[model samples]
Target chain A: MGLIPRTIHDIDTPAAVVDLDLVRRNIQALQTYLDGTPVHIRPHVKTHKTPQIALMQIAAGAPGVTSAKVGEAEAMVAGGVHDVLIANQVVGPAKISRLCALAQNARITVAVDDARNVQDLSAAAVAAGVTIGVVVEIEVGMKRCGVAAGAPAVTLAQTVAAAPGLDLVGLMGYEGHTVAIEDHAERAAAARGALGRVIETKALCEAAGLNIREVTGGGTNTFDITSKIDGWTELQCGTYATMDAGFRPHSGHMFESAFWILASVISRPATDRVVLDAGRKAVSFEPGGTPIIEDPSGLEIESLSEEHAKVSLTSQNPDLQPGQKVRITPWHGCTTFNLHDTVYVVQDDEVVDVWSIAGRGKFT
Target chain B: MGLIPRTIHDIDTPAAVVDLDLVRRNIQALQTYLDGTPVHIRPHVKTHKTPQIALMQIAAGAPGVTSAKVGEAEAMVAGGVHDVLIANQVVGPAKISRLCALAQNARITVAVDDARNVQDLSAAAVAAGVTIGVVVEIEVGMKRCGVAAGAPAVTLAQTVAAAPGLDLVGLMGYEGHTVAIEDHAERAAAARGALGRVIETKALCEAAGLNIREVTGGGTNTFDITSKIDGWTELQCGTYATMDAGFRPHSGHMFESAFWILASVISRPATDRVVLDAGRKAVSFEPGGTPIIEDPSGLEIESLSEEHAKVSLTSQNPDLQPGQKVRITPWHGCTTFNLHDTVYVVQDDEVVDVWSIAGRGKFT
Candidate 1:
């Protein structure tokens, strides 16, 4: 059960609350599953953006933490996590300059798909007299980023080897396509194929005389599949720490909604409809329509404006009135986490602590 | 022309940039149109969230500003704004207490659509020894967060009048349904009808012995319509300061896109597809759809992940490449503004100043 919010009544509405019990349970589940597995866990910080959560995950056996931006890496370093991997490409001098500064103290690794970005990182690293780890990202299945898997990976690794102040650690690939699918079998099959591509790229790199130490890939949805694989080094899972509504029901794993937006009923205009103080601004209404509102029987989130969430009472929702607090589970945790600055760490009915999302809006 | 970007190139990518020239034009347009009219201008701070913009609007003859939440009002007051109307309801002890505390400094007003909430507000106001302004929110066209127009509004106004420490301040009704319609005449006709309901409620409140002083309603889209109406005392326009993609083309006035997410091309995976550094997290991708990518020929925003915007090229665009900066115009400015913490206020190419979004994620 979540913590009782006995002391949380005084908190204003539309607050982002993370249930501590659920968080611990979620982390414990992941640790238990990967306890003896060869695959190491480097939890991605994009979902929480809080250094404390990453530290907690580190304490729970995560080797390090992953960030999507250079600013996030700098923030995580500030949060005292010395080992950081920026899982996305770092382009341009403005960011590369930050990367060079970050590499001065921490063990910084960054993903690169393009040769130009790799060259830029090399120049920045050389300028700072810091040797940075490089992970050539391969185009597994999510065609958004990354170079082609096999020969292209070798070429990138060769470039990394040739560049001064750069060490080719391994490769990284994100199986984003299969991460949130509904069907279990299809997602598992797709995960196998995606991870297979990464493994293939790794072999090609190794065959080309590249030393592959850590192949960081996989996410919350496919971590199990990658853990069961032979050559996968680490899992950069983010969502298993705080599950969102986007995760479909499956027999693969059990992850509950650990984080939610605590909203209050502000308008009770009609018997069949009500409005909450929180809407798209507070809750993460992803590409997947509206977020799931925690039980107010027979009431469904009809639509959301910028500041108001209009809920339709299809049946008798007599208890739903103004000032009553409610919880909204978001569709996606990463994007939702970006919208908040602080998280009210709570138990069922009471807030226990508050953690600042230190790396929020670190897009630069 | 936007201010020259002499120093903007060094600011990194995936940053929110505001064209100061366009912002001034948008505000000037609203002020010019509303000048000498019977209606009043009260710019809603939900769009910009910066007290500087609110101050600018006030300096441009806006009587006051409107906040979606009490926290936003507090933020504005901290930025030296005294007259603020939180045009949403203030229910619950926590919010009402804060509102009361805020009223000690700022001339605060709020909207209500229920009697119990009115009683609660009255009790809170009486306890705080502060008089609060109350406006009955009539359900005009949008069936959300508002009471019925005529008698129900009168009933609520009577409750406001009877309650201690509360002063009835006429009514508020927003015609959100017609704001984004493509057809101008239809939207204007709907705006007239919507404002007509609020006007009728004011008459009903007067006939029912409730003295009405300020009738505040209407938004950016319907401000033109409300200005033509006879009884609209004030206009709470928000989006006129920074426009979005959802607003249909209207010949009534020219409103340029002032706010943009300056994103870098992170990946050029294929000749026909490129990924932007800014995604759904950076740009405000509302339920409406993807935001418009400016100046990219034959390229359309195909999809957005949490951290990557995928743009598909229908035709070969030889010029577009990785590391190039692009501007994304959001579909909803208010929600978009909430996602960002600071906006680089640029004239054209060079950034003139940077404003911290003081009210960002002020969900309460």
Candidate 2:
């Protein structure tokens, strides 16, 4: 290519620009925080969705990468990641076949809460002649997707252990409802209370003649608390690598925000208002946490259409005109990263490289 | 090479499925409504983002397609459409160059609200030796992007007329603020009042000796009111082809909802709770209008995680179990279509064809 833009100004507008230094710092910070603990780091690939960054996280002491879908796990394997843990349910015949196909090349582990789903996984694994690891997900408090954390969890683990071509690896329970509590002591108490059932379930499974080797839990918001809970073997923190506005209020001191959406001011309709080219489609409008302009001047995003952000200037005469560039911090990094196909890697405001978000739109 | 799935049961989960018969009927309904009136339809392709669907709308009776970005316009031109309108501001040098490149083989028109952008467009048009059409977008009431609707619009029209290699084609102003008012009389009154400024600006431009031939406004919610209003030439009602839950409250009886997200029940955590494979990533979670399950048997979406929709059964046990499929209607079709790469075209629940969402991520 013809000399890819060396500086951020030469790059196109509405582009996902990533700070490489901050990304490395964020990864290093998480690894450093869990250095003295027994918990291993298995960074979630859902936030960045780029395989290169997953590799970087793996290089920085992450045991493997955690994916939210089977398609994401497949992409990680194709990009040279040896071990993958799909942290969600992989349902239906097509996805089960796809999940089984990935086990032929590398270590593929999936979380399941239903006995029927576990049976289907066993059948697919036997048909494909490959072994797939199973992690029984326990419903701690999130109440989204997990079996109840008691005899139910123990029974599922027993069924997984009895299935053919399947290896019962561990137990998983995410304290999602208590992750972003915003108070350190309150968050600690909530995490401990939610994860107590997980520890109990692990003990129950072990007491029933089962070897539960791992117990995984933790979000980026509660990684510090969950890492110290004595039983969680790994922290599946995804947004730590690319901090967002939503989670930054609670975890700002630990990890630096590295991702930004670079947009151009396209319309200065009035003296007090200037509209940017980025809107809900470019950034995300997550509830209770909308994106903000990085200038920190008296500028505020009033509303968003499909393709434009109507920003009002609280300061008098900001000198913003058409074609002027501004950086925006997205509310939710995972959803915002899903909107773009590529991100420009930057260091010190200079373009370093370009990476494709290979795992985006991998909903199936 | 292999036989495609003939029925919806064989298709993959978390897929965007479009009913071809409903889509054509919606298109025909809108076309029939505007037949006796003098207003022509220029459907916005931002909702579906498929070139094949845009071609279908053109076949029904559309002079051109309206796009929200330059990249979408480029895709339309490459997909055998000769007339395209970039309905939003296209800033920066790279996009301007790309817009001019498309004018080499098609009639390219764009909306502008700033003089600096007009100068840049004129310079780029001259450099590329192509004439571009310009539409001065007036700020009716949306407060997003456009010039003030009186003398300011007239002045911008003058500047556009003086700019070489640019043709002052028409005037555009979207009454987005009042389109979904939910009351027929109130919507009609609001549409008339907002579009009144557009007609006034056109008259003022004509008084100033500018050939303002076209005046465009209206969303799908106020298409009927806008078509009956005097001095309007076209309507840009996009969601009429694929009605969404957000706009269906006001316009449901006129157009049928044509899109559905087919997802599999992946988790049955409790007797009253069943989680689907589709979540915010598969469907949209737009504020004030989140998606709903198509089954009317007392099913409700409680919350959404990244990859799972926590749905609750309002009544006693509804027979939804793991591996069973359900259809979902999205809150907003435009944002929902942006998440998929391809849509499976279905007719009577049979797979008829597959069309790529060619303009899904054309933010620039």
**lDDT tens string, model 1, B147-265?**
88877778778888999999888788877787877687888888887778788778777777778888887777777787788877888888888887766355255688888888888
lDDT of 1 by residue, A202-296 (tens): 88778778889988888888877878878888999888888887763542556778888878888888888888888778777766656888755
Q: How close is candidate 1 to the true structure, as a TM-score?
A: 0.96
The TM-score of chain B in candidate 2 is: 0.97
RMSD of 1: 2.9
Model 1 in CAPRI terms: which quality?
Answer: medium
Query: For candidate 1, what is the lDDT?
Result: 0.82
Q: What residue pairs are clashing in model 2? A: none
> Least accurate stretch of 10 residues (summed lDDT) in model 1 chain B?
B1-10
Give the residue spans of candidate 2 off by over 4 A: A1-3, B1-3, B314-317
lDDT for each residue of candidate 2 in A232-350, tens digit (9 for 90 to 100):
78899999998998898888578888999998899889888889988888998867776878853556788877788888875564678888888899989999999999899999999
- How well does candidate 1 score on lDDT at residue A276? 88
Give lDDT for model 2. 0.89
Query: What is the DockQ for all candidates, taken in turn?
Result: 0.76, 0.81
* Candidate 1: Cα lDDT at A331: 78
